[model samples]
Target: MTQLPSAAPTIATEPGQTEPAFRLVAVAIEARILSGDIQPGDTLPSETNLAETLGVNRSTVREAIRALEQNGFVRRETGRKKLFAAVPQSRDISRRLKTAMVLDHVTFEELWEAMFALEPAAARSAAQRRTDDDLAALDANLAQMRLALHDSDVLTDLDIAFHHLVALATGNRAIQAARLPISELFYPPFLAVISRLNAAERLLFAHEKIVEAIRDQDSRQAQDWMEKHIQDFQRGYELANLDMGTPAALPRAGHDKQ
Candidate 1:
């Protein structure tokens, strides 16, 4: 057999040899979005146009778009149609943070302590600042929780929504944003405990009490009640035979990298 020429060895570049062109483009586009040059619901320039405008390869532009999409800077319309600008949703950011916490094996005590620090404050503020719409939202979530007591999926969603509404009722966007991830992780265990203990009635009563305190604008009562309610969940977790020391479970696939 004839001898073949040896293939060239691939050279491994060091860090910062050259920044990825797509990353640079992503940063530039993200700046535009943050500066309000591209508002939510506005369509991004077409891929071809973006490539030309950014003086990069079309593939690079596509990569940049993918990064933005993953980070919640933009999203596709229904049916995977045209991409549009989007405000970075608190929920999306929270999901990513929760995934990280789970993957890193965050302790239940740490999680609970964080919740204790925030939830009571949120309750107090919500009591003082809640609007009529906030009240309506809380009522709707409570009703949904009542209707879905036996349905784990529905109950879990309502529990999360209820907490989010409370955060919004505080009328502090920063607090709402900060609470989003912690709240998402916080409710699943509640649902799990409720499911095992058949404690829907108790859960509903607690929720009603919280709502009433908020409606009455009783900040101290709201704070105290919410703290007790949350601590009650920790107690239930133990009663349900769950390992409180074990870290929360990660979503099946893996952590979502933004």
Candidate 2:
């Protein structure tokens, strides 16, 4: 008579607890990647190979690959059967954090407070370290802003980009990641308020001052102007009678690009 197969090995956990096979497989593959055994651009082993090497079913390995792909740990080229390794970008992670913040019901007050601490710090850093390229980018933004000041939608996009360029000038990865999402939500409502109150000129003037301070390597001046600029946002919002208690959101429809 044929003998029954041996039972699978077990790990320590609470009674009646069993990790899903796919999850175990995913963890195994993730460990390989993190250990640098699988560098980005290295193609993953075929499902058949993984199943055989890991002593799991092909279906389990397939599911694990799917999970890894979803988490940005694995990427497949178009029209290709092989999956390549990939390091998840800070931007990809920031988008998820932004969604989580919105779901957590974060408000304009919370975002503004965070900006109050972060933007001034970023401006000071940018002032000390900004390059010719950084100044050029800011100048370009201001040029666009000059024409878009009366158009809230165009102004909104440029405003968001202006602050981002400032953050990039600092060359700090941590600060960049910290502000990316908050900045996404920060400007839209405030720009709408600015437009309603016709304070675009004031906003543009502040931006010009801050950029000049950065160009001059004047950290104190940059910090002061950034602080004033952020304060102006709050002031304009109040003047427009918009509620600060409102959730931070994307600004409404902007001018037609045509």
Candidate 3:
């Protein structure tokens, strides 16, 4: 029964302005959430209550709530009528961006350039900040990687997981957020390189070097190893005769991890 701020929104309209009243209502609610006047998990007022408070029609309130729900600012349990205030998570936001990237058909060269800037920085940060738990997880990943060297499909999935773990080890949410969307797009090209060049051993070697540097807290060595590893990928792609300028693709069904 937490009440919204008592003041009605002051929505200004210019002559013949086309902005919908529902959007203004949605923005008002989002502003309150962002400003911490309301918190995630707080129960939102009923639509009627909201409409009364905002001096809007009930239908406008419903539309505004729909917008908030779509943006991840509100939610209700399955089979429940009560909406709760919420914040958008990075994963949810990143998933949308990932979908857009796929639909836009971004190039492998574009993906490569982004990873070039991000992965080495992630490795370096992981080396500095990684905990014993991070090392153990990485050790487990490497073990699986060694066993999967000849299995290109499994190895590619492991390769994706390995980089994800490195990003997690960085203890930087921003890095993790930015990396998640781009990570899945790597699967197709990675699989091609490993399968075509039989480059699993080289991949394993680079991973080992990077992990060793991370375990020893040698940030520079970790970054150098990662840079070389990523560079080797481009070489493998060229050797495999794949076009880097070609639009990247989602991993084919049965190729992605469950």
Best candidate according to lDDT:
3
TM-score of 1: 0.77
**lDDT of predicted model 2:** 0.81
lDDT of 2 by residue, 182-211 (tens): 987787767766878777888899999999
For residues 1-258, could you state the per-residue lDDT of candidate 3 as single tens digits? Answer: 566754455543335657788888888889989988898999999999988877778998899899999899999879678999999888778767776787798988888888888999999999999999999999999999989888888888888889999999999999998888887786556666657787788889999999999999999999999999888878888887888888876656334421
Q: What is the Cα-based TM-score of model 3?
A: 0.90
Candidate 1 pairs with clashing backbones: none
RMSD of 3: 3.1
Give one digit per residue, the lDDT tens place, for model 1 in 1-258.
Answer: 111111101112225647677777777777778777778888877777776655667898799889999888878878775878887877777788888887788877677778888998999999999999999999988888888878877776777778778988999887877777766666776576666787777777888999999999999989998998889888888887777687776545554544
TM-score of each: 0.77, 0.87, 0.90
lDDT of 1 at 106: 83
Best candidate, TM-score: 3
List runs of model 3 lying over 4 Å from the truth.
6-17, 252-258
The 0-to-1 C-alpha lDDT of every candidate, in the order given, reads 0.77, 0.81, 0.85
Between candidates 1 and 2, the one scoring higher on TM-score is: 2
lDDT of 1 at 61: 78
Residue 76, candidate 2: Cα error in Å is 0.7
